[model samples]
Target: MIKIVLLGAGNVATHLYKGFKKANTVNVVQWYNRNLKSIETYKNEVKITDNVNNLIEADVYIIAVNDDAIPELSSTLPFENRLVVHTSGSARLYDIDQKLYRGVFYPLQTFSKAVDLDFTTVPICIETLRKKDFKLLETLGQSLGCVTYKVNPKQRPALHLAAVFVNNFTNQIYRIAHEITEKQGAEFDILKPLITETARKVQEVSPYIAQTGPAKRNDKKTIKRHLKLLDNPDQEAIYKLMTESIKKTHGH
Candidate 1:
């Protein structure tokens, strides 16, 4: 079994730890973090340490810390005799120094502390320190049932940006719609079918082809009605911009 050390106790770490443990191919010999108390509960099951120097020898170190903390954390870890990886979609592997076996293992999905996640469906993007490390990563990815993609820093950043548009921005739109529904004294749950249908269409049709609404049809009447319905100027602006974008995409 490949020995591993996992850093951090946050969303990424928790999910990865669960999945890696389930795989049984990896032996999590040690887990390190800045705050000793953060992982106090798991101390008995897995050796947890606050001091970087006390880290147990492992074949690979998976750094799942916050984005800003990665470089500082990487600097402290003993990178020799081990492969080192971070799990951020936006951060490049080379952002950290090359003194050690450095790479990125970005999982392309938003993680929430409160929510349960299925790592099987999460797209795992792997970049590596060397050709030797590639096989190790691929093996780990398969254990989790992930759809793996080999991505470089530049391409990873682009995919991350697209994720923001599709996931983050889409969630924001949902929030706005929910608020509007509440204001109208209607259950926001009423829109669940429409939202599901939108997602379903995308799987079969290109997003450009699946798009519909006042914007896609160039229906001035519906556009004006929605704008009138929304009291918030920000919502109106978003609707207007999306409408224009859809029209431009569909060649309306």
Candidate 2:
């Protein structure tokens, strides 16, 4: 079994820990973090430590912490000639340097402590400097989920930016829509089926083809009406910007 030591225990860490446990092929030998509460269950399963020096000897060590802390944590690690990996979408894998086998195991999806991750649907973006390390990453990723891509830092950033638009911006739009619907005495739950259908259609059709709403049709009157209803300048500005972008892309 592949001996793995995990670092950090946030949303990503918790999901990965559960995934690793379910994997059964690899064994999580040890873990460490600043807070004990973050990884109490992980501690129960394997050796856990607050001090970095006591880091268990493992074939692989994954740092699933904040993007800013990666450089600091990687620099502080005393382990030599061990495979070190980070699970971050925006962080470049090389931030950890070439002195050790450093790689990225970025899972492209929103993670919440309460939500169960559908690993099979989550795209795993992976990269490594060494050929052997890349193969090792592929092996582990396949067991967790089949969709895996080997991408460079430049390409990874584009994917990350696209995700921010699809996930964050879209969710924000949903919130605004919910507020407007509530004020109109319409239950936001009525929109859930439409939301699900829209997501489902995207799987089969290109977003350009599945496009709907007044923005796609260049209905300026409807756009103005919606913006006036929004009232909030920030939301109106966002709505206008997104509408313009969509028209620029899909409009003739």
- Top candidate on lDDT is 2
Q: Which candidate is the best by TM-score?
A: 1
Mind giving the per-residue lDDT tens digits that candidate 2 earns over 1-252? Answer: 777888888888888878887886788888788888777765557788888888868878899999999988988888778999999888888788566789998889999999998789888889888889988888887777648899998988899999998999889889988988988899999999999999999999999899998888888899888888887788788888889998888653
Candidate 1 regions exceeding 4 Å error are: 79-81
Candidate 2 TM-score to native: 0.94
Instruction: Point out the worst 10-residue segment of candidate 2 by lDDT.
Output: 37-46
Off by over 4 Å in 2: none
Query: Tens digit of lDDT per residue, candidate 1, span 1-252?
Result: 888899998988888887887876878888888898878988888899998999888877889987888888888776464688888888878766567788888899988877888988799999886888888887778777898888876899899899999999999999999999999899999899999999889889887677767787889898888889989989888988888888888788
Candidate 1, residue 144: the lDDT equals: 79
Name the lDDT of candidate 2: 0.86
TM-scores, all models, native as reference: 0.95, 0.94
